[model samples]
Target chain A: MNDLRTKLMEAARSHSPSDAVPIGFEKQVMAQVLALKSTRQPGLLRAPVDAWALWTRTFLRATWSGLGVVMILSLGSLAVPPSDGDDSDYQGLMVDSIAMPIDETGGEIL
Target chain B: MSLLPEPSAVPSDLELVHAVRSGETERFEELICRYQARLFVMARRYARREDEVEDIVQEILLKAYTRLETWRGDAPFEHWLMRLGTRICYDFLRQHQRSREITSTELSGDEVDWMECQALPDGRADGKADAARTLVARVLDRLSPASRLVITLLELEDKSVKEVAALTGWSVPVIKVRAFRARLEMKRLIERLDREKYL
Candidate 1:
């Protein structure tokens, strides 16, 4: 194992492949450097936004996201339905607000 | 000797960097011209294709330009540039390693014979430096990115542990540990290759 390791190291050190920078590489870099900040935005916002196109794209993207949320919530609700089953307090509040008749004095009926 | 007064002194890398930061962006081009070749050589070790090498060099230069403000003058500019270049190459290795699939079929005839010779205790594979290099390269490619980076620096580049640590921003013990694991990985890869070839 040591011998193989030594041999591999010797072989790697012996392999000296030299590469010359491609022609115009410096110019290419300089060109990019000069345009770096300007190119970042890509002029996307400069173009006029068609209201219909904007809505269509928004609707398409939102469709999948909305569907995903709905599916997750549906599955979650099914997995853990309200199993405590103690709703008397909640039912009383609803009945009082919807069914009770109040006098002008606002006192409870005797 | 007709000595013309020495040609205009070449601007130091720091001077150019200062000029660049002072809004003389054109001076950055000189830095590019000075270091691009060295950067390409370093990048070529990680990337085999010419286009990939070019992209790596371009990224290093662009990154250096943008991050010039972060460089304190405590270290030489070349050292700083090389450290940055090393990190970029390692990143490139990791990103590309995912897509690089190696197989026994890719081994050349020379590489196979070379490996076979090494399998024997007394056998010697002389005059096959190219084959040895190919085999080593294949083994290196199969290694994880961290292992590949460590082995390349510690073995192929003949860097000391401290130097490797400095280049990679890793601690000395980390470098030592990685070097040990890298060697083990290489051994395993070579053994596997040998097995698969015969099987």
Candidate 2:
């Protein structure tokens, strides 16, 4: 019984193409792989070209820009004149003296 | 990305994947060369057109390489590839079966009869093992994707049920039941073949 089946299997496998790789299959796949390799990301997350470097440089540029603004504000404040316009309402009252009549003296309290 | 690492230094698929992740492209190719035949055979059995088989094999290889990061390395890489190819083929077959029209008679008569009885043993005259394998491959080809895979992994590849489940993303109980049904189906198919003149 077993002999019968074995013969059949041998016949089947003999005709079967077990390892018939197509001509240039490796080259074709490798070509695609080369293209694939070019598309690979540089990190775990695919960062765009100059993403991090550009961001850091922009940040530093903005920081200096902010410092310039601060310096300009300080210099502008220093260049302004001090307060010169004073109120004169209380100036005349500062020296005004009130005299009580001398008690029964000094020309009869005139 | 890192350059492809040395093959001799990599001990496992996981290590190879890590190396690829680190930017070693050759490691990926190493993987492809090693398993391409297996995947191609499995895919060919499913695809009707030779072109379709080649496309599916390339597609699977590309997908496998691209998604190697997703591989958990918990199961054998070959089993994982088998699972991928089987699923793809199943989807393809199911789609074609729905859309295509074929005469029942043609389906049965187009192929020549398989003379399973004539196969002789080279050294071991007891042909039990080899005969059984031929019978099994035929039966396997007829089975549903889920059912066929259980036997392919557990019987042919010597994977445990747990390993099969892990590779297939199926539960152990599901794998076991499918395996049982697949075995029954194989027996029935063999008996039917026996009735035909091929045996």
lDDT of 1 by residue, B1-199 (tens): 7322233489877778767776778888899988888898899888888989999999999988777776777899999999999999999988888534566788998988887888798868887888998788777778889999999888888899999988999999998888898888777777677778797
> How many backbone clashes does every candidate have?
0, 12
lDDT of 2 at A31: 66
Model 2: residue B185 alpha-carbon error in angstroms: 3.4
| Lowest summed lDDT window (length 10), candidate 1 chain A | A40-49
Best by TM-score: 1
For model 1 the local lDDT of residue B29 reads 89
Docking class of 1: acceptable
Q: Where does candidate 1 stray beyond 4 Å? A: A37-110, B1-8, B99-103, B120-123
TM of chain B, each: 0.89, 0.57
Instruction: Report the C-alpha lDDT of model 2 over B1-199, residue by residue, as the tens digit.
Output: 6554455654567667777766777667777777777776766555546787788777777767666666666777777777777667666655544312222232222122233323334333343444444444454556666655566566555679887776678888888899888767655554556555343
Q: How big is the RMSD of model 2?
A: 18.8
Pairs with steric clashes in candidate 1:
none
Q: Candidate 1, what DockQ?
A: 0.24
Which regions of candidate 2 are displaced past 4 Å? A1-20, A34-110, B1-16, B24-27, B44-50, B72-86, B89-93, B96-142, B154-159, B187-199
Can you give the lDDT of residue A26 in candidate 1? 92
Measured against the true structure, the TM-scores of the candidates, in listed sequence, are 0.72, 0.49
